[model samples]
Target: MSPTTPHQPVLLRLLHSAIALLVFGSLLTGFMVYDRYDKRFGTLNLPIVPNTQGIHGTIALTFLILLPIFAVYCFHIGDRRLVQSQSMQQLGQQLTEVGKPIWWVSLQRLTNTFMLIAATLAVVTGRMMQEIWLPTGELNHIWYIGHLISWIIMAIGIALHLLMSTKVGGLPLLLSIYHWRIRESDLPKNWLKGFKIKPNSSIALIIEFVVIGGIALAFLLPLFVTA
Candidate 1:
């Protein structure tokens, strides 16, 4: 395939679009909910939505439902790209590697990892927070605090994701996902065949799973603390 030609896999494109919508929706509604209830860090005076908390909760549930599918696809098909190399001898070497496709790809993977982690944290913490609990005069719930932190992380993670995607793939890579012309051989039926594991993929898969587990652990911490 030519470098400029759009060549994203059909399934990956679909899943990416679906997950992006859910994640962005959750971010928007979650921010509204935060602004309405928890402006302890100051306020943006963002437009208030009716039943903002309920709307945010619904978006969160939708995100959680779709997250597993994306997570699995990422691990099974995209895990090799997601795992960082353990052979980096120094931070300087890694910094020198920037601007190349490999570096951008690695940056993309790392950003995706953190984005997933932050999203999970937000969902888990938001679920733990009582539905009736609003900031009102003052708020002191541990889950609420955790949710705030996750929201901040999610925002930063998403910002980095966009920047890195642009830096690495530019318009061609970004547009590839939105482009609709899948090659005849790259249809949905061929997706499973393409997912066959590589010879050295076990180590990469292990790293991917470890990262995912650590993110889940972040989500579970509040429950353990509050218990």
Candidate 2:
């Protein structure tokens, strides 16, 4: 079976779907909160929800919890795809190699990595931001600025991720993450069978570790900040 068409493993599919839903929820509520509370650039004409801040905070909390779980799953089960190829030549060659097996040495890796980074930024900055602070019209906090930048990064990263996924794997690959059917062999019961770390160079591993550490720090840093 082609990499693009193979049935996604059940466990991974579940995790992916949950993460996607939470991310979407977080993004939507986040936009609404931004529009209602902070319109420094240009105000959105959409109906303002008075409670959007609460909704946004709720969704952000859920996203924060899910992200670490997804990160661990991706790191262990899917880290190879997050790794970049050593050379631009290899990446370029992979781009040209349509119909080749799905591997880490492609533009998809770049998009995936960027999306993870953006999401991490969003979660960290979101956590650092206070709902009361926004309602008071205080838009000058460093963390709030970081959160705004993360929102932009996340928006671009998500759009690029979808576009590249379509170009590389088409609709089937996209749907595979949420597909209902799972072959018995691909069931959760078989999750660990024959599973092994996908080959990645030391440099790739190091990069992945650094990114993960950054994400961890993002989640933990606010705890140390004094009021």
* Model 1 bad stretches (over 4 Å): 1-3, 86-99, 135-138, 196-227
Return the top candidate by TM-score. Answer: 2
Q: What are the per-residue Cα lDDT tens digits for candidate 2 across 1-227?
A: 23556477787887788878888888788777778878887777679777888887887877777777777666667665665455344565644664454533366777787787788878777777777888898989988899889988888888988887777678887777787886886766787665446535665566556656766776787799742
lDDT per residue as tens, model 1, 67-137: 76777677777565454554232212556675656666766777776776677777777767777678454
Q: What lDDT does model 1 reach?
A: 0.71
**Which one is best on lDDT?**
2
Listed in order, each prediction's TM-score against the native is 0.80, 0.84
Worst 10 residues of 1 by lDDT: 83-92
- Error in Å for residue 32 of model 1: 1.0
